[model samples]
Target chain A: MKSKITRIIILLSYSFVNLYLIVTKKILKYVHPKIIPIIVISIIIMSIASMILILNIKIENHNKSKKNMYIIFIIPIAMILFIPFKQSECLNTNFTVTQNISIDNKEFESAGKQSISNNDVMNSKEIDINEVIENNKLDEKIKELILENDVIVVTDNNFVKWMDELYENKIYENKEIQITGFAYKESNFSKSEFVIARYIMVCCAAHMAVGGLMCNYMADDIQQDSWYNISGTIKYETYDGETLPIIKVNKAVETETPSVEYVYPY
Target chain B: MYKNKAKNTTLHNLTLIIITLSFGYLLGHLIVYIGFDQVSRTVKIFSTKFTSIIIEALPFLLIGSFISSLLHVFVPIDTLVKIFPENKFTGTLFAVVAGVFVPLCDCAIIPIAMRLIKKEVPVHIAITFMLAAPIVNPISIMSTLFAFSGKTNIAIIRVLFGIIISISVGFLFSLLVKNKEIINDKNYCSHCTINLNNTVWDKINELFLHTSEEFFNIGKYVITGIFISTIFQMMFDSIGLNNISISNNHALLLMLLFAFCISACSNSDAFIARGLMNSFPFGSIIGFLVFGPMLDLKNILVLNKYFKRHVLIIFTITLVLLTYTIVSIAFF
Candidate 1:
């Protein structure tokens, strides 16, 4: 009689889980916000069911193994209880303040540079190194100002517009600046112009977008894939309906390529 | 005899339950106190973003379990013995291919695979199916489409590559581990050995009881996975790791680590991938989504239970390589 009752309980619970699975998927699509509570309830029910099932099964001659599995099962539940709830706190905090600050100004900026050792500024900051170099000449005063302020808000959608505005305003003309990034020689190999590029990642490196700045250098001196710190003044050019910022080379020197090259811009 | 059998089965089950609950509680406490808030937060974010993953996946789990139970209940061992090809090589090939069509996730597939083992299926075939079905199923493909937002080519590439790797690795391992002595024989508990002589109501009651026991056993892990993932997500957002600038390649590394920490299901990993698109390189992002569901922190615990340690290790290494190669080629 006990066995029969156990069997019936199992089957009904199994059926309910299956039904919930099917219904929830559809419900989540039409009304996405309700997914959280539904998921929480589903998880709770599933956990209870799992505990009961684990209790009923017996592995002959494997007491230790069964014990270990039990440990694995309970650990996450305990974590759930002890871990302080922080989701609400996180939602309340403004992520934008950090985003607006340039990578060079983040609280962990110095520590990050120290840990990595290679001072690839392009990979470290929110401002495009190329864009910054082109739009604002790195006069000692300007460089010092940037170092002090230490935040650049660069987004893929706003990059071109920002660059155009910087050029029109002559924000970086004849001011010596330093920019570091990967060197991508334009395929056309124009004698006096080439593109320097860096990857911009938004979430994790999986969905990376590329950002680049045009710089004019003597054909013989440019090397593809070379990492460089170019000190230059900003110049503007128009090509095929797009405005391009040209880093008028004051000085160009190659630097060691950092061991890690692609940087995501959050 | 019946009374003795019932007593032994009951004792075994009760012991198993006690062990599982104790372990679950211990691990949960350790994670919370250990100060790996980064991991905790990633898990939480993943759970919140992909709540539908468990829901979408539960149906497949139930179906797989039902089929396994049915096979256990009705199929005779002698009849099952003749179902495979006479030639080992041909049998393995058939098994690997068939495994691709089944589409069971790692957690649920174990029960089905164990059933097959009992039904006299070659261990090689069972292993192959266990690995292949989770990533190569119709739902996985459809979910990938939703994650990538109509990148049919990426989805196709992932599925094709997934199958090739699983089959090849499964076959190689079959050759390396030829000892069939480890396989368990099919022996139902006295409770499971229902007498047809009983009334219809009795049979129904028996089935329900058996199903609930199995459901509860597995359901705990699912819930744990969801809760851990939810907490991790919250922490990740709070810390603002998403905004850090590291090179595209390094960003991929972080993403892979993050995915492992969160342990999202394969079906929902793509949605997480989509959310992260702006933060990392395309290749690295692909690696995070692909490699994670196959061999992350949580899935590894589940896989460790069924597969030999060496087999699991080899599987993890191969999956990482395959995911990296595919992503590199696609993005480059």
Candidate 2:
């Protein structure tokens, strides 16, 4: 009788974790939409099984020692209940602040140089702006950005790719780009320079990486880790003896943070 | 005498209720304090990463357990034995292809594989299924392809490499393992697989019973694995592994270790691999793609419940050497 109760409690807890993920809407933060069906199906199957097992609790008692292992399963329950969708205070706190500010200029230069040399053969010729336009399967927002006469909105989805292309091909050097993101500055950055960035998420929040573009604007108004909208023309600037594209900001406005903190990859 | 016995039982129940309520009250207070007030940075970071991993992985683990239960209840031993080829080469080869057919996650494949082994399926073939299914599954391959931005070559290479390592390891284990009993407990099979030839309702009940059994049995190790790997990832990230300049071989070694330590699900591991693409060499990334799903901090603990010490050692060594050799030859 004791074992039966333990088994029911354990099985329900397993079911509850999946059900909790669905209820709290925290499931979206973890997996892609394509995998949702499988997740739902699994939850239903497990829940049904748990209910069936409870009805017919004729399980032969196994090793008594194994009962101790069941205690560990409660960790997920505790985590889900206590910390569901809560932001970590340490995320943008002092330690991260210090780490973000203490950047190595030489390392950036080397990284920039390494990328140029490594992909020189692959992208030797200039990239055709028409080629990107010709790709019909591209996101409509990106297509709209391309179709705009001179100004382009660098959204969270297209920010990383746009920056990579602008860095490599240098075709959009003179076009005015409008981008909005939080301000991030490295130690090596000058007072007038910072990055407009968002965390790029390819799979889940756990695998997110920082993706942003360099901006040269007045730093007095923009605070670290605060959101802002900046309109700027693209230009190659020599910083710390390395030449890379930077947005020469024409206007800056403080803005509220976006609902979605992380940017999904396009 | 009867009145005294009833009074004793009533006292026991009351004590249990009182203790539970007090514990709940304390726990609620503690959580409220932590949520509102400040805590150490390490504690916050650990909680965030730990929750993220468990949340992301629970679905896969559920799917795995569900499949394992289905296999335990429905899949007959004769059906498997008959389908298994007589030739050892074909048998191992079939194991590799069989993974593609089942298309389950790493966490789910172990219970099914263990069941097969208990059913007297060739131990090495079952091992092959265990290693290859996580990597070679259609869902994983599709996700890998998508993650690499439609790079079919990388996806194909990962699948091919997974097959090669899985086959070699399977064959090696077949030669090395003398005993057929892989599980530690001998009586585990008797209760789990019994009542198979019963009425339909009884069979259905047994299915759920066995699934619940299999899930709870393997679920603890997974939680332990996740806790350890989360700490490992946090330390590696905070320490800034990318800051160090590493040689190609050195990077490969580091990446392989990272793959083992992080133990990200195979479906999403490609995204993690792609994230590391610009910083690390292609070979090291490929090494990570191949090595991670086959073995990681969590699955290793899960595997320990089944395989012997020497078998695991052989499995690990053979996979590492073969994967390194193949990746080195291809890229370097």
Top DockQ hit: 2
Question: A173, model 2: CA deviation in Å?
Answer: 1.9
Model 1, range A1-266, lDDT digits (tens) per residue?
34323433444454454345345543322122323353444444444444544454443321111233344334433333344324332222222111211122222111111111112212332245445544344242234234213323323333323332343344555444456665655345576765555443222211223345567776467776677776666665554333445677666788886543444321
Candidate 2: C-alpha lDDT: 0.67
Candidate 2 regions with alpha-carbon error over 4 angstroms: A58-60, A63-65, A88-90, A93-146, A156-169, A236-245, B1-39, B84-93, B101-103, B150-153, B178-181, B185-190
Candidate 2 residue lDDT tens string, B62-154: 677667667667777677787899799899889888899877668778877877887778877888999999999898897776554424567
What residue runs in model 1 are displaced by over 4 Å at the alpha carbon?
A1-266, B1-63, B78-106, B179-209, B239-255, B308-318, B321-332
Give the Å shift of residue B63 in candidate 1: 4.3
**Against the true two-chain complex, what DockQ does each candidate achieve?**
0.04, 0.28
Question: Which one is best on lDDT?
Answer: 2
Residue A227, model 2: lDDT of 86
Instruction: For candidate 1, write residues B1-332 as lDDT tens digits.
Output: 58645754664575456446534644564576676654454434333233334443344455555566556655665565587776766766676567657755556676677667656677667766766676777756766764443235456656665666566666666666653543311223224444547765545444434444444344445544544544454345446564677886677668777877666556556555554554456667657655665566546644444455566676677666655565566555
Give model 2's DockQ, 2 decimals. Answer: 0.28
